[model samples]
Target: MTVQLRHLFALATCALLLGGCASNPPATARYDFGPLPAPSTSSQIGTLIVADITGPTALDTEHMQYRLLYADARQARPYAYNQWAATPFQLLGQRLRANFAQAGVKVLSTTDAITSPTVLRMEVNEFTQSFDTAKSSQGILNVRASLFRNHRLLDQRTFQRSVAAPTPDAAGGAQALAEASDALAADLLAWLASVPQP
Candidate 1:
């Protein structure tokens, strides 16, 4: 073959190989919940108001950058292969409401009737996910919460736990986050149930 023809043939082969690599599917992540534990029983159905989680505050500075995955400056990251999801504040609020409902607590919106004497307000201080090098790109989720009623402090707690992604890929990281969120919700419910009603 002439030099120019040989060069063209080599270029075509490289293009095909690169295209195949680009189209390859990301690895799948697995999530497992061991059991569905019963919700805590409450004798009185109290009005629990879940305010929209407030923050992206200075408290969040520590974790703000952690959620972003490393990427090349020129190449934008792929959302389909990225672990980005609802903000932590939104996720925590949703999970909290679900847990309260499962525990037989009556959740009230801000405008709901105030027949119930007590109100529960929560402030989230920390919600972060980061890669753990020891576990080969596995990630960890950490959350902190505080509770109040009628502008007086009721309770405060911090929750931190690590979850392992199925692989080093983004899908695996997302799965790990879901697992962590579920576990946190369950724990939060249990804690709330244990608290004595005023």
Candidate 2:
């Protein structure tokens, strides 16, 4: 082959490689709940330990999920190129601890030496964005919250919060989920206050 023809072939190959890289950009977009409120120091409540949140197999991973209400209301989908920095279950525990601490409620972990302190156990039943239309979606957060004191169950409640997405994309769902999380934290604190302490 001629030198000019060989150079042309090399350029073509390079162009194809570059185009492939462009089309298949790395799936590196990572989202997480932002900074939490500072711990409060005034009128303190007794310590509460947060247990690891449990959930179904689908939600056990870091994949960000959504339901397609427009196509199939029962089907859930994970974004191909988007993901949470951590699983929802794990994030929930972290956020709850932060929220409780900020409300002047001493937050403890399972690793603490205390044996009978109040415990907050949560089962995440549903956590996903559901798209009703191509242009709109809502973040749905559902959890069964149970409080234990002195090794006895004190109170249990199911909390559900849905927040409208500003857009129909994963970013919108993430923002909505964050808002719903804040709402859930507030609701849980109120419920805990009303429950009889051990």
Candidate 3:
């Protein structure tokens, strides 16, 4: 073949290779939380009084990016951002209410219902996020909770759960966080059920 034709062929091959690399898209990750189990029949029937959740509170901030190192010594890089619906205090309150309701307990608001037989209050101790790099992901949530009754301490507990994206994307990270929150809710409910009734 002529040198001119050979040169043209080489340039075409290089362009094709570069084009393929540029068109490649990152993998997408998704998460689906299975349905939660119902409360056990052994839970007690009582008036559930939920007081205002006092904080030092923690909230799901807008999603951000972080670096990840794969197991193969390859750098996966970072991309995308995410966020959550409620703060830690808000999440705890909602979960407590839902779980108690499922147990057939009546809920009493402090403003409208003052005649409740018992009052439940909670204090948040810790809520923070940490990152994981080996899994090509960004964060984990840790929390500590305390329970009270009529201004007296009833029980205090700590909870920790890992939240990570299935893929390095904002939506996936958000989904992981939400799933972690739901798991926290379930754990809190189980603890509440075990509390002695007044």
Candidate 4:
């Protein structure tokens, strides 16, 4: 075959291979908090509404993020073949609602159309799986919480948790993140109990 014809053939073959690969991407894995633990038998803390969680625009999506602290702690990267079943906030909210209800707290939604003197709000500051070394990683979650009465601030605090990953891959990161999120919820619940409700 002529040199030019051979080159053209090679380019066509390369394009076909690339197109096939693009069309058949690897299966993506989705993660979420698996299940609720044993319910709390405590009585209701009284009527309280949980406002929708707010955070930086980055946390508004279904991306499962991680950071390499040993490399560039400032940069967060997404898993190519792993993701959350929903936005991080959505999942966290579900867990919080369930936990509060299980604890016998008369949990109310922001849209419940009911009057309540107490409301809980959260602003997620950071949520990512951070790797300190090639084989060492932890899921870090940081959030600022505010308790309000009559739309005025009643109390506020920042909560943070870091759970070690069982392994070094995305699966491990996901598990660690789930644990960290649960820890945050526990902390928030305890704090609520301490606040002077109106």
Weakest ten-residue segment in model 4 by summed lDDT:
36-45
Error of 3 at 119 (Å): 4.0
Clashing pairs in 2: none
Which lDDT tens digits does candidate 1 get at residues 15-62? 999999998988533322223346654424466776666664543221
Residue-level error in angstroms, candidate 4, position 10? 16
Model 2: per-residue Cα lDDT at residue 80? 82
Index of the highest-lDDT prediction: 4
TM-score of each: 0.59, 0.87, 0.55, 0.86
| TM-score, predicted candidate 2 vs. hidden true structure | 0.87
Model 4 C-alpha lDDT per residue in residues 1-198, reported as the tens digit of each score: 999999999999999999999999889999998887786546447888998988999889998998999899899899998999999888888888887888878889989987787899999998889999999999998999999888899889999999999999889988888888778877888888887655
Better of 1 and 4 by lDDT: 4
What C-alpha RMSD separates each model from the true structure? 6.8, 2.8, 7.7, 3.5
Tell me the tens digit of each residue's lDDT in model 3 across 1-198: 999999999999999999999888664443223243565543554676777666541233322324333333233223332333445456556665665677677777678656665666656543333235543664454556666667677787877777766765555655565567566666766777788867
Q: List residue ranges in candidate 4 displaced over 4 A.
A: 1-23, 40-44
